[model samples]
Target: PVHDDDDDDDDALITDAITGKRYRALRHEEAESLSDHLLSLWMRAGPGRGAELPVDSYKESVLEAVRASQVVVMVVITGCGKTTRIPRFLLEGQVRRVRRAECNILVTQPRRISAVSVAHRVAQEMGPALRHCVGYQVRLESRPPERSGGALLFLTVGVLLRKLQSNPGLQGISHVIVDEVHERDVNTDLLLALLLSSIKNNPDLRVLLMSATGDTQRLSQYFGGCPVVHVPGFMHPVQARFLEEVLTEMGRPTPPRRDREEEKEVAPDLDLVADVIDHIHSNREPGKDAFRADRRGRAGRCQPGHSYHLFPRKQLDRMAVFPVPEILRTPLESVIIQAKIHCPHSKAVDFLAQVLDSPDSQVVRVAVKSLMDIGVLDAAENLTPLGERVACMSCDPRLGKALVLSALFSCVLPVLSVAACLTRDPFYNSMQNRALVSKAKAALSGSSCSDHLVFSRVVQSWKELQGRESKQEFLDQYTLSGASLRFIHGLMQQFGENLCEAGLLDASAECLRLSSGLNQHSQQEQLVKAVLIAGLYPHLIQVKRGTVTKGGRYRPENLSYRTESGPVLLHRSSANRGNPDLSSRWLTFFSAVKSNGQVFIRDSSVVHPLALLLLTDCDLSERGNARPNHSVLLPGHSLIRWEFSPHVWELLWDLRTSLQAMIHRSLRRCDRRSTSGGCKDSELVALLVELLNNTDPEPGSDQEEFSTENIRSDRL
Candidate 1:
């Protein structure tokens, strides 16, 4: 039931009208007699009976092209049936012989939902025995209960890259169909480059670059003019309208505009969308006056008496047809890790330069620097033991770091929930079910403005209600995605297993369960927040106050924050968006991006100034080499004058160092017996627990912000 807007296929599940029984399409059976009834059903239900797709005509050409060349460029639009049908064509085309080579066709998709959906469609067509033959492998989940051996395997682009780490030559895969190459995402580009290199050694390995809007000539040239196959798609006609025309037809007067500075402080008027929809329904006609508008300028009529045709002579582009390559748009921590493991000898920047359409040099540099800050990569750009483990996780490098630290602190359950939520599709719809989802989330969140904690509660409630009610009913009541919930659960279990392997938790404790001795830390709010800091440090924003105006009427005073770009308000969907009293002076945000001409923080959590210092990378001045007024200087010369003196700062530093050592020792113990008893209930944990529990702020300190000035300067 999880639908991706990117997929345009109109195929629905087949059902019998008389019996109301749903059935899969008849599949080819190797050892069966084709009776008259079975033959009639096959003829009626198979692909040939429906309006023949363009790919059906090109099956011979496609197979011949694969036999002739090592690479092929397939430029087919959406709904051409290329994604689901072409793979089966290749698989079934194999000649039955005494010695059949392992000919597994690997089709890689850009999104997980696409891979799972396409695999299900292919499985249904392949019939029951072939149910195991057509399967998908995505992060945290795999169908058919096996790692490999699916005749036609569908997986995400990132998963394929991870596979390359183990089998750089892609040993068993015969043909790799890189779908949506037009996206030019970081994973797809990296994967294509690696495959091209592998094809030189293994010429038998076939590559197919498929896209709806790709530059065929460019791709063909990249493969040394590989054969290009064109498959025409069924296109749908759409109606278009400009905003100004819609407003005129609806008889809504335009509001006066303001200066650029005033515009930055105003929120978008979303009510206009509903008004346009209502007008379209109330006034739409068949032939005449359907979309006609008055031809008028602000001062005078544009054409005196004639009605202006609203449709443009040329089609107007609504949004960018292609995606911005992820290197430019997203954090590159995970990509950096992959680069190190796959291209070991080359530095991250050097290896990335060899990729097709490499990201900007500064962007790569910033990514490497961020990884170093998080202790994933050392000063020499080597993977630490922590980095080795983090690379195995299927999430952002920072979130992986958070999970590791949470395990060390014996608070893995909630942190696992937070980590899983970050790497999956959102639990609720902010557009249609915003108010209801928000009210439920707020009730669970209590006084915490941390979106991570709020989501943890939401997921925990869903878990508690799992058996009492059906999953679909629970999802309907909460307006959540069932697939996303399953994805989160899969990741939580995956994290627990990985933590056990890394010796961060007791071997006996499975799936988010902590040792009994360490269970008390799971209940502490400050400890969980501190673990989040270890992962999401340096992405901090200083909260500021501003005012927002809408239509010159609803001008409300607003509290906003500052990113490198400019001032940004929180998304209305955020738990902390309009609430200023929930520890809102400063916060750490997940991402800051511009949408609808205004920048906004997607998700954020508040951190106390002291907690920030304890969690971040800091060093105390040596006794002999002290700064004036006992100041503790962070990176970039952001100095913090100690509330007490040098000695108090030194004591706090020593205590933190001891706690880190204690955690490391606990993680290094290999035997379950050694990990089960002493370390979990040690006096060190008790002391650290007491320290985190203290909430009283230092009375006379004048520090107003905890800034990552050093981090920013290093990136520059």
Candidate 2:
């Protein structure tokens, strides 16, 4: 519970004359009455520069539209003060006048950084009392101060979705503004659908959807033809150009993409983009035509909501209007599970299909089918016991599954750290310090191929540094953000608490013994990799015998062990990038994307093929071929061939089946009581570790071979 310093005084009580009820006396009432200072407080707590913004002219209309309807669509430009001022306007201007019901404004931002910074800016604009009035809630931090009377909450969309788990109707919040709806994440899309469904029962609830550029007509129609309001602001006109035109202007020929799949979705060519920008800077007068250079002579500056010229103009054309919706770009396992919880009686595909600007139908079908295969959902697309547990975890379904299995397998701490690192940014190295950062990362990795282990080492180093030096020194040495480290630490504690809350951890000696077995560094590393394999089996890849030239540099070709997406390169940030000897032959990756016209795996770990097969759902391929041609079928419809006798193959399958049953039983037994049951087979654990130890090490590629720079230059 959060304690308000202002309301903690014991000597500030007052008794009503007739009712005999005790209440805390107002702080201002000690010297001045409430009515005497109302106007002064209002002026201080309102918009700081209300006269300068275009939004001020339409403030009264915005309030009136909300009062008359249940929904409103706001089309505001980048810097029009819509995000920070609208909530304050509603709380002070309209809700105070009505006095029928206390109003609580909840604003949702698409990004966490925006949510926290906006909350701080709003609090600073207001005076002292308004400081307490404005609070923010994100994944790892929350300051919910006295939400009953009048409060302005700035939260990420994910937090609001979690709140809906308990308060589906959003009982206390009078109005909710879903900001940045154009950059549609899965959570934002889900929130819109939930609000649309709930508003029918909650006629008094008000919702405002704000975006810089959106499908206003379609969204307004979705909200029952809600009134649309556009607030204009000042912005410079931007020119667009084609890749060929820019390259020709730079006196260079167009470069070819590495493969055919890359043509579908290619990141902007940054080299060509930089050359074009330089040409523009040399040809035009800076003060009149473009942003003036700073003392450091960096000519271009990326503003908060404006696009930068560091990407191919063609790609910028698409991003100028909107970002690629996350549903189409990212894996949808967690989303499918959330949909199941929201519409338990309906099919997951059917429910997601109804969402506005619904994602690809084939994508939804594939996600649902994958979940069913993982045993999270049944054949009917209903949540199983494991699915319910996974739904409550604040992570991707795959990572959440890894956490659960880690607890059952007695390696929760390391896996918890890994999950936290994945959720939060642990490293913030800039291009100038890339060499030093790479060296430090290598030292932390301790010759492990797994980036997850490297992250754990970095976190441990940070903890050690906390006692010896200042935070600034640590940040400088590690090229990390201090805020990001604190956020990760908070998430670590929260994940531990969640384990206890889910009954997946306990005080029993047996459970403690299993977890304690991972005290040794070697033991911990092996178990962590095993849990990872269990979670991310089909994403494994292998080194193919080929070479490709990317950006005038040659690197070995990589292929997925299952899907065969070829010519993949290790991301520049990976610890294993420059090491000639990789830890293992096969690898498991978190994400694969085409950036800069090259395929790259973001975070990856090398794993033994035999170790991976242990976690796979083993079944014989359906073919009427000879015995030598028979192969084992794996998840994602992948097949693996090995030269083993039929008897030995049957024995391995039996062991895998046994391991699968033990994992299922242990997870099901984890309930509100305590985690007590798990496999205690020492020989099996030792054998799996031994197989991983005996695998041939992977040959590493050059770190500077490929450049995977971010194409989206701005975070608007």
Best by TM-score: 1
- Candidate 2 per-residue lDDT, tens place, 306-347, comes to 123433445444454455677767778888787776768887
What is candidate 1's lDDT per residue for 440-533, written digit by digit as tens?
Answer: 6566567777888876776766777746357568677656787788878888887777666555666424544444543457777667877787
Enumerate residue pairs that collide in model 1.
635-710
Deviation in angstroms for 491 in model 2?
3.8
Where is model 2 more than 4 Å wrong at Cα? Answer: 1-52, 98-101, 232-324, 423-443, 466-484, 497-501, 506-522, 543-584, 595-598, 620-658, 670-673, 678-716
- Each model's TM-score, in the order given? 0.74, 0.73
